[model samples]
Target: MAFDEGLLGQEAILSLFEAARWAASASNGQPWRFVWSQRDGSELHKRLVACLKPGNDVWAPKAPLLILTVTRTTRERDGAPHPWALYDLGLAMGNLTAQASSMGLLVHNMAGFFPEKAKELFSLPADHEPVTMVAVGRLGDPEGLPEKLRARELAERTRKPLSEIFLGQSP
Candidate 1:
């Protein structure tokens, strides 16, 4: 997603995280956490940008906010590995996306980042796994993106039809 340099208010960012906090998780063991940085040219922002891969670095820096998503690998209650941690994190992200859309904002989630670097930068514990990074802001001109990315951004959105996706018998 394209994004302008407009700053998102603290309240708005807090609301986004609140939405994420309400996401359902296995046995109510909410394992998702986030490290966030605003595009104010601060040291935190610079370190966050450095975690991005080359391609993401080109566009993500223009967004007003960036967030690194992480999940606790073990269950807090028993110290066992949480099998559904990744799935739970996905649900939380879905909530975040829905909330953002309602607020007239766009979110671009990227896997193109150095997770190891993020872990080191954030000093994350061994049980926490870095999952993805998100860029958040209002929509901006696609012209700001590289020529190839602009083409992709302007291309028609496509998804698999229900008929193809549904393998079971029709209800």
Candidate 2:
């Protein structure tokens, strides 16, 4: 049960990626790569569809699109292993998610995907590290969600208090 759902048009999708392309990275090492899939009937699509966890499988189909994010750690710029590559990729993803939200599209980041299955399904290289999957769709009716999700739909999903998360001098 998302807050809202309005799928982006092709032009909007391009714009969203264009915005993501500019996110700042550690040492300017842009390590993010995205592979997008729509709910089209195809062998690859079916394989990816099968990789989702059962809980996600329920509402994910209602999403307009899916993005498989990966990070490239060893770049010519760094040459050494970039432990922060994944973090940098997250930053870019944050940018993408925010931009999509601003555009009236809802994004659900799912961690329930099977990475091994994703690697095989997408034919990823040995060096390419697959991260999470993102589901973007028009926000459907929460009431339409299954009983479990509906029960949790309006549950107080709260962020940790700043006092707990921040460990610095009080401003």
Number of the predicted model whose TM-score against the real structure is largest: 1
**lDDT of each structure?**
0.95, 0.79
Stretches of candidate 2 exceeding 4 Å from the true structure: 2-7
**Deviation of model 2 at 143, angstroms:** 1.8
Alpha carbon lDDT at 144, candidate 2: 79
TM-score for each predicted model, relative to the true structure: 0.96, 0.89
Model 2 over residues 27-109: C-alpha lDDT tens digits?
88888988886666556556667778889888775566778888887774747888888888988888888898888777788
Worst 10 residues of 2 by lDDT: 1-10
Q: Over all chains combined, what TM-score does candidate 2 have?
A: 0.89
Residue 58 C-alpha lDDT in model 1: 88
At residue 142, give the lDDT of candidate 2.
Answer: 87
lDDT of 2 at 51: 78
